[model samples]
Target: MTMQNPVRPLLTPLLAALVLAGCATAPPSLDKALPQTPAAFSEGGVPWTTAAPAEAQARGEWWKAFGDAQLDALVERAERGSTSIQVAAARLAQARAVLGATDANRALQVGLGAGASREAQRGLGVAPNTVLSAGAQLSYELDLFGRLAKASDAAALDVRSREALLRSTRLLVQAQIAQSYFALRALDAEQTLVHGTVEAYRDTLRLTERRYAAGDVAELDLVRVRSEVAATESEALALERQRAQLEHAIALLAGEPASGFRIAADDWRATPPQVPAGVPSTVLARRPDVSAAQSALLAAQARVGVAQAAWFPNLALTASGGFASSELSELFRSSARAWGIGALLSLPLLDGGRREAGVANARAELDAALAGYREQVLVAFKDVEDELAALRLLARQGDAQGQAVDAAARATTLSETRYRNGLVSQLELLDARRSELRNRREALQVRSAQYQSTVRLIRALGGGWGEAA
Candidate 1:
């Protein structure tokens, strides 16, 4: 009578188990783990039409909007050379490699092995026998509980997070370069104004000295005029020092040595561009930080699924085919060949709560990731509001400052005429000149602030500005 194979009886039951496990659903996505987005920003005025997701869009040369060729060049150089960007890119590559490794777990693994051995029974005084073996072994773990799939998903999300971080780093470097360049230019303008004032003061001091020598003015008046010239000259020197410091900062941002880099003195002429703050929801898409945080949260969620899957049984299939012979010449002969195949299903009965602790840890990580994502979203909103308010208030301040500068200039001109005609004291003329200088410097400061705010806003909005198509 023919006997049935013993392992064949278990195949039907194992196949049924596999089918049941196949119906198991994957972990739910955490995409909605956020508060409701406001329709309009508190400081951004009314919301305009919502734009398509800007994260997927290329952030074309937003610096070009300022119409400054120098700024464009500096930002481009910084993007290419910034070390922060390089670090983030390296992290992205690592995450991608991890993903490739995680995916490899789902594919069959094959390995070739060879061995030789000699055996002897010492106590029996038997002769030694030589053995030689060569084989290829294969193994594949069936994803019966979705553990491998969830791990792969987590790895992929990690790659996405790293990619977003790289983009964020690039945007930050670009913005820093632009802001520093503009600040250096503003200082140049201020230094020029101070130097011109110093020259004017020097001329006045010469006139005062001549008048004192002719006995037409007191020695006290001449002494005061000389002191004013010295003070104004000192102020010009201080401004020069500040401009040098700013130039050094710009060089560092551009990835160049401060000792060798130089920016020639130029007029502050780059106009701050008007960046439109579209509907508040668009910030979620545009901001790379926000995107990175969201990806982290999803990855953490997938890890939780992976941890939970640990409670289920693991299934693996292994196979090996080989040639073995005592003599090397007969190793590959048909009679020396061997082959084996196996399927293993294992479930741990006890592990001192290790699996439970793993689940707990993964869940806690998920909670932390969720909290981080929410905080990032809130901070992004706050950043947009802060820059919008700064731009608005600075514009008004600039207008008022312009009027003050105009009035101060008129006062200085009148004071000069009165002093020359001996109708006003030398002290009054000096006060008017100081006021004019202060107003001009303040105006330049307001302009600088506007430019810096524009760059910051672009960064907050993920480094670009344009109407949505």
Candidate 2:
């Protein structure tokens, strides 16, 4: 009694080490884990304007920038009906439920029970006795090593990742709706142009037939004009087929039956809006996919901490209050009352390397998450750059195509006049008309590309430019 026990000295240091380990269980800082970001984007030439921080803001009706009411309605319909968005929302709900379950482990557990048991006596002449018991029990585990906290943190991060995925899904649906609508409108414009060309060709064919009947033109001229008329009509039919397909696509995107849906041909005047590319870091912060990957990485890191905690001893305190009696009717008597209190500390002395394997697996998962996050960031940067390059090149192409169309139209007019005066062959007039049709169709295609690219840029930037709007 006079001398202190030698085990007491060791216990103090052991407890100190355990406390230090618990304190170190927090996940690493995100700044150190994340890859370095560039200060500015590489592509230049278009005016780069600074936009307000959108990381915490909602994307807000970005499709409205196109100034099409029908488009806005379609996007709203898609948002409400898209199966992809519904799936993502369901996943988010599941993650939240898991977080709640993980948190429940930290709260005191309570239970009630009643039982009756009969046991035979070992001695001779002894009869079986029945004992009745009823009780309430409560238990709670002490978070001595931060295991529960780490697990909760991981679950919370999982919820965050699912939330980001839902946002990403919604954005994708909206962008698809915009692109399909713009494409349908482009086809409408092309179809109108082609139908008008067919009418002009028919008129030319009629004039040629009259000339041949009066012997003013050769039979070869009449045949050539007829062929042109047929070819122009065929082109118009092709455009009609294309527009029908586009309408069907838009209907599918809007979650409607293709057979019953239609977009009437109207004037195409929706101009692509100018989108500003903010700083590279800001873009990364705004992208929901990138945010999801980052959250996954953090969750993996927290799981590592949880796995390491398995090596520590677990402590639990339990209490029970109950009634016990040899006679069921007397179970509630004061003399038959029973109560218990317990404190248990358990540590696995030998596990055949199971804990080590778990730690290794957790670390491997953490590495995978880190790599995935890095890949997501790289892809985000690439998307923005690709769309920016496309918009720049498409704008220049549109300008050159416009000039070509003007020149082709003037040539067609002159060729028509010359052929009427018998100064040019019908073949020259046909060539001029073909060139004009080709240039006009190409110009419309370029405009359609501009519209699609603009929508993609908005998606790439994670939304519209909040302040630049």
Return the clash pairs for model 1, or none: none
Please give, for residues 57-142, the per-residue lDDT of candidate 2 as tens digits: 68788889889988988888888778788899999999999999999999999999999999997867778889999999999999
TM-score of each candidate?
0.92, 0.90
Model 2 pairs in collision: none
Model 2 residue 33 CA deviation in Å? 6.1
Error of 1 at 424 (Å): 0.3
Candidate 1 TM-score, C-alpha based? 0.92
lDDT tens digits, residue span 137-216, model 1? 99999997789999999999999899889889888888888888888888889889999998989889988988999999
What shift in Å separates residue 142 of candidate 1 from its native position after superposition? 0.2
| Least accurate 10 contiguous residues by lDDT in model 2 | 45-54
